[model samples]
Target: MTSTFHVRGGRPLKGEITVRGAKNLVSKAMVAALLGEEPSLLRSVPDIRDVAIVTELLKVHGVKVDRDVATGLIRMDPSNVERAHAAEIDAHAGSSRIPILFCGPLLHRLGEAIIPDLGGCRIGDRPINYHLDVLREFGAHVDKRELGIHITAPNGLKGTKIHLEYPSVGATEQVLLTAVRAEGVTELTNAAVEPEIEDLIAVLQKMGALITLQTDRTITIEGVERLGGYEHVAIPDRIEAASWACAALVTKGDVFVQGAQQKPMSTFLNVFRRIGGGLDITDDGIRFFHPGEPLRSIAMETDVHPGFMTDWQQPLVVALTQAEGISIVHETVYENRLGFTSALNDMGARIQVYRECLGGSSCRFGWRNFNHSAVISGPKALHGADITVPDLRGGFSYLIAALGAEGISSIHGIDLIDRGYESFREKLTALGAEYWED
Candidate 1:
């Protein structure tokens, strides 16, 4: 069944909301359980579609995944795992980038793996060239099959140095997971230093893996002979936190986001403050509101971790439409990220896309008609309209845009929003948002 959200706009949202575990970290943590010799326990897991898909994928691979919905805890036991059925495995091929992380653990346990085509956010040509290059560097024989990637480490996997041309999150994670079980030491330079990556490392360390973080740019791993099961609490969702923060700005409301840690969200908080958004950090969360002045325009550039996240860019761009002056956004992560801005433009926004690098960064999308840069001229009154959500973050941006617009908005493809958001309908209702499913 498909669900769409019918939202009545122009409401000032109030009240407190708690964020769930990090979607990015929880999925990777589930995959890490496959590498363990015993059952691993993961806490703070969110009830979402992508996590459910990953759990099913692990079950098909002969891993026993026991999920406790009430407690948000999951136990995965791969002790008796042997082989994965291709038909069952292929059903979820191209579902997410996460399934690819299983390649290393599968090869480590069964000596071979057949991975189906990968799928995730379609913001650009997110090619797996970097993944294949890093895996082959570690002595894995990779062959492209009709259905997916066929890999074998007949001579056994060995550790090697990998240098990524771009600090891609997926590629960096693939290297870390695959290299942790290799025969020797693996050195990775120019890796993505996202907080989720750090969380994964912490989980690996708890499982008795010999890993060290040398500076923010490099990681050194000494492959161990065996890994033990571990128990860990996943980090809070920073992307979700930032999205709700933008919701406060767009609606000119006050919202308190519980469980949103400030340590990992410092960069985003700084940007929000620069745009005239107010923040107050408490023991367990952060509260966002606009008290006196309207939002101000600021320049933004998306990059790897510790920089502006690409996932948060869409929602923030929507909020920028209510700002005073012109706002510039340069997307350095994905080429097609700015395409969703057209939907906002349909609702009376002055946003222009350009093919050249407008904000002093040479992005991959700059020369290819990808329109890597966006210039938003705003303080315009937005009217609600029917809009279609293109992807996860884009869908959330539409929700924020709708909350600040006049009249009614009918948003389609709302199920995509559920892939990451948990009980979003109930939460919005609690915060004074009039949303219903039709």
Candidate 2:
């Protein structure tokens, strides 16, 4: 069951918290370990629900998974991989989409994979059809069963060309993991080039996959007959790093986010600076603080990689609640991302959701029934309220709202936050946040 957090607000969180591996990549990286013939070592793995879920799923399939939580080092062995029953797989799948991606690796080893239906954050419509489509292009026969998805490659998987209608990260990953082992050459047009995808590519390359990156978001992979293992360190969680930074801005606090990188966060930092957030960045990490003055509001848009991330939208929106003047946010990635603003409005943030496009170029959601844009008129004094956490990113955003509000806030479903943030309660305590779990 999910727990509740009672937070006494209006406290400036101080001190430091370290960010570990990217939650987005680490789980998939563990899945990639199944493609290897020998043991693979992944370092800087975070202690999170996704990792734990993926670990248990892999273990159910007879993959030997071992980890040192203190050091964030994980060693995965796929030498004796076996097929897990649907019930076994479904029990471990618990609220993670990683199970679908496992079909590619499992079809290669066991010739068939029964994956439970997908489930995760309810941010928007994230259909698994894209993954299914990519797998079909690679010669895998899929049968939709009552309980789960059944996939097989009776003739053995073979590579083929594919063009995505949308450059989805999960679909691109499905192509990469499957293509690396299929026969002949595979070329994917309009593939997602997120930093996490790049990191996964690096891991696959370390396992003897021949892959090529083109200038125009095209990836070509030459299937190899056999593959070995790899030892590598994962990139830090850019999303988490930016979240803590947003917390600092919202609560008028100071925080040193260790292990936060600069390259992946350049776009977010630029926007953060324009919004009147103070920062002292270094080779080690970034120290985010309040400007000690009024925070300025600005117009921003969430986009694909090398642009502002959609995941960074919620927490930063809470920070925007403290800024003077109106802030416009155009969420081009997810159609319903602005839905979290309802709770913030209850806490005194004046955010309005719109069905029409605002602040940026037109997107796929425009001219539709979906409310994909938002306008926040801020410098509003936030008061505490009873709220339930929604999704991973949105849950953390609620904590930021609670910390900036006056009086006590009763927040439930905080365990959802553990799906991404590692040891957040301890980190909150270290930062002097007056909160207790019940």
Candidate 3:
């Protein structure tokens, strides 16, 4: 059954909330467990839909997934891992793109990997061609079937050099997972160097893999004959921390995010300060609040790591609705990210989507027909409206708009938010944001 949230607006949210492990890192780490010859212990695992999906996917492949929910620990034993049926894998991995990451590990272990049609957020065209091409580079033969693609390595897998055109995260992950067990060293240039990728590298190292990061965006993995278990602590959820920070700004509230780190969120923190949001960076966590001053609007662009993240742009856009002047957000990451702004516009915010890159250098989608940029004319008082949660980040942005509106908002498809945010409703209640289930 679908769930809905009835949010009563105009009250500022206050108090503290804790964020868990990075959603981006945790799932890939779980997939990395399958490469180990022994059980891997992962700490700080979040209780989210994606984690659950990954857990189920691992269990289907005969990995023993033992959980300690109280302490957020998961012990994944891959000793009994075996080939899983195509239908079974499809059933557990519904609407998740994680199955593609399984291709590398599964092909190494079982000599074959079957992946059903992949699904993820509709923010852009995240095709798996990069993944398929990477697999082909490693001598995997792809056979298309009615259900999904079946991939197999006739000869044992061998490492090869790969250079991504756009530094796609998934392609980089595919190379890392596959190259760790291949026959020779793999060199990858123009790779994604996000913090989550670094954490994954740490996990691989603990499992006896030789990997190195260059000063440039290049990664090298020396293939090993065997990999053992890993004991690792996943990184904090910077996206979730930034999302709460934006929530505090939009509602003119004060929030103490208990586990936020300053390093990963440095770019976001800079943008938050430029937008006139109050922030205090500390050793433990970051405190975000409204400074009781007029919020300023600024031109922003979303790029890869070290730039403003595309995931952070959605929730931050909700706060931009309350800014005093025109704010231009050029989304260089996703083509359809600004579509969720339509709901905010319905709530009395003045946000216009444009096909041309308005505030920054022309990006890949600038000359294309895709409307990838947004111009928000704000300080407009927002009212309540019925809305639908589109994707994970977009869903959270809707909740932010609803909480800051002047009237009650009826939100459908609220379950989408659970894919990333951990116990957000409980945290919202603790922060004194008035919301009820409908």
Candidate 4:
């Protein structure tokens, strides 16, 4: 069944919503459970499609997964993990890129692993070569087959040094999961230091993995003989928190996001403040609201951790439409993320995407023809239109546009949002958002 959201516009959203464990972190932590010799308990797990996908994948591998939806708790036992059939694995994987992550753990536990063609949101050209190359570096033999790419560690997995061309988070995760149980010490340079990555490291540490993060983007992991279970609470979802913050600004509303943290979101909070949004940081959570003053335009660039995130670019772009003057956004992380702006333009947002890199320093896509930079000319009045959700982040941004538009918007492909945000429809209702699902 296809899911659609019919949203009525021109009303401000106001109220409180809670964010749970990060969609980015929880799925990976689920994969981490495969390395544990015993059962592991995870708390603050969100009710999202990705988590469900991981749970199913684990079950297929003979891992016992006990889940409590109400408390957002998951107990995963990988003590009996075994090889699953290729077709079954492929069927369970569906369009998720998660299966790629199973390679290391499966290889370590069963001496072989098979990963089918991976799929994810159409946000960028995220290649799997980084993952495959890291696996090969660790003595895994990769073979191309009709069923999927089969990997085997004949000589047993051994650790090695790896340096990433870019600080890719997924590839870093692939290395951490594989390296924690390899035969020797592993060192990774130019690794991604996202808070989610750190949280995963914490999970591994709890499982008896010795990992260290240096001042530089280098991470060192010492392979251990055995790993035990861990009970861990994941970090809050900063992307979702920032999304709601942008929603509050776009709709001229106030939203108190419980479970939102201040440290991981420091960069986003600075950007939100620079755009003239109000933020009240506390020990518990952060409160975001419009200051009733005209929103200001600012030049921003998306980068890795400790910088403005690419996921924040979309929703913030929708809010930028209501800002006075021109706001420049340079999406350096994803080469094609700005493609979603066309839908916003259709809703009367004056956003122009350009191939040439704009705002601060030139990036990896500086010379590419892809439209990676966006110039938003705003304070433009928006009218609702028929909208199609593009990707996860873009889909949420479309909802914000619909809520702020003047008329009703029929939004299709809203199920994409379920891949990330948890209880979004209920949260929208709590925030006084006028919407219905069909």
Candidate 5:
């Protein structure tokens, strides 16, 4: 069902909202439970849509999933891991591309795996070619079917060396999930070394897997015969934390985000400080606010790790709309991530998208026909306008814009925001946001 919200603006949002586990890491950690012979326990789990989707997928495969509400713990027992019907998987997955990661662990457990058509946010073209190519190199057979694709390991999976064309996070995760139990040694070049990837590697290590990493984007894994269950507390969601930080800057309010760490968000914190956002870091969390001064403009670029992430640029773009001068942002990760600027333009913000690299750096999309860069001219007052949510991060950006606008904005497709944000409506209410559901 499509959900809509009406947001009354020109008010600051202030209060404390606690964030939970990282969505990118937690769901994959749940999927990693399939490689275990015993029960696995994950703590600080969030009640997000991706986790719900992963839980449903695991249950249909004969894995028992139990959640404890009080302690926020989820125990996944994959002792009876078996094959699931394609129709059931397709029905439960519902636009999530996580089913593809199941091929490796399922092949190791049941000798075959069936995957339905994969879908996700349409911000850009994210093909599964890198994932499939790695699996094929590891001795898996792929057959194309009408509803989906069928993958099987006839002679068992054998680890091999692979060099990724791009540092795709999903493809790197597929390798880690499959290579843990494959025969012999597996070497991966150009692997993603994001914080989520490190968290997954830690969980795998706790389950008795031997994995090694080098500074030069190389990961080596020694396959074992079996793996046991793991007990871990997943890292806090960095993307969500940065989103709230941007929200605080955009609305010119104070918000203390509990469980937000400074280490993972160092790059974002630097940008936030440069843009004249108020920040107070404590042992437990971070407090973000406005300094009652004019917001400054800065030119920035988004890159892989140790750089401003692509997911962080959207809400920050809304904050940038209030900055003094023209702020330029070059999105090097996803080609079409700057598409949300059109809606901002409609809301009276002066945003111009360009096909060239506007941030003075050359990237893969610079030579392509995609509009990968944006110039936001600010100090422009935004009036409320009706807008439909596009993707997850973009949807949250619209919400930020709506709350900071001068009039009431009718925002449709807020359900997309639940895929990443945990208890956002409740948090919004706690933060004194004026909004209603429809």
Candidate 6:
């Protein structure tokens, strides 16, 4: 079933929108439940496609997942895990990065695991080599087969010191999950320090795992014989919050984003304020707008945690198009993320993509046609046009662009947006957006 959104443009969105759990964290937390010996309860779990994917994957692994539609609560019991059905597993193998996380938990509990290829944002060649290397360090033998990844723990899995070449989020999580149950202590250096990673660690620690976060980028986990269940409330969706903040900027509207944490979004809020955007932050939420000032252009570069997030770049670029001067964006994360700018160009945005890294910075997408840098010359009038959303965040940027355009826009593949955004249509309607199903 395909769903499309038809949006009539030229509306200034005004309202308070609350964001649910982080999509990036919920799926990983679901996989983390496999480490438990009993049932685990997760609160603030959003009813998005990715969560559904993780739920179906967990159920196929012989675990029962009970979701409360009213409260957004998820209860997972992995005590009776069986070998996940091959056909069902293979069908969603390439669906998201969360599946690869099963390699550690499955191998630990069942002595073997077969994980299908992973799928997520098409920003670069996201290889699981780091994951495989970390698992091998933990005494697991990994083999690549025609169907999927075959991982076996013949020696029953022993912990070892594992150092990541890069602070890849998936790789760091894989090491933590696999090493926690091994025979000896595991020391992981160069770990990804994203807030979601910290949240995952909290969950693991609550399950009776002994973990220590030392300064100078080192994490030590002492192997435990068994792990108990945990109840955790997932972190608020910062990506969703930033997306709505950009929506407020592009439409020149006032939006109060509840459930947005200020600490995790300091970098984004700093950048937003630097570009003549106004924000009022409280302990619980943030309000974004521009009060009595023309929007300015600012240079931004994406980095890991505590830096400008690459996912926030797309929607902000749409807002930057209306700024008076040239705004430069350097994406250092996924290489192919800049492709969506071409779709914005079709809607009369003056954006030029560059293959070579600009602003004296290096990036993962610098060499490929990924176009690591984008220069937006704006204050140009944008007319509504038909566009396709290729990924989750990019889909919302299209919606923001459509809202700021004149006339109407027909956006296809809106189901992709629902993978992350919860109650998206209802939220837009409350914000005074004119949209309908077709």
RMSD of 4: 0.8
> Can you tell me which runs of candidate 4 are displaced by over 4 Å?
none
Residue range 181-238, candidate 3, lDDT tens digits:
9999899999999999999999999999999999899999999989999999999999
**Residue-level lDDT tens digits of model 6 in 326-382:** 888888877778888888889889999888887657765666666778889977778
Question: Candidate 4, residues 252-291: lDDT per residue as tens digits?
Answer: 9999999999999999999899989999998889999999
Error in Å for residue 28 of model 3: 0.4
Model 1 lDDT tens row, 316-370: 9998999999999999888888999898999888899988887766877666777
TM-score of every candidate relative to the true structure:
0.97, 0.99, 0.99, 0.99, 0.99, 0.96
Error of 1 at 222 (Å): 0.6
Colliding pairs, model 5: none
**How many clashes in each structure?**
0, 0, 0, 0, 0, 0
> Candidates' lDDT values, in order?
0.88, 0.93, 0.93, 0.93, 0.92, 0.86
TM-score of 1: 0.97
The CA lDDT at 72 in model 2 is 99
Question: Model 2 compared with the native: what TM-score?
Answer: 0.99
- Mind giving the per-residue lDDT tens digits that candidate 2 earns over 1-438? 649989999999899999999999999899999988999999999999999999999999999999899999999999999988899988988778889889889988889989987898998999998888888888889999998889999999999999988788889999998999999999999999999999999999999999998989999999998889999899999999999999999999999999999999999999999998988999889999997999999998999897899999999999999999999999998888888899999999899999989998999999889999899998999999999998999999999999999999999999999999999989999999998777
Candidate 3 segments exceeding 4 Å error: none
Cα RMSD for candidates in order: 1.3, 0.8, 0.8, 0.8, 0.9, 1.5
Name every residue pair that clashes in candidate 4. Answer: none
Whole-model lDDT, model 1:
0.88
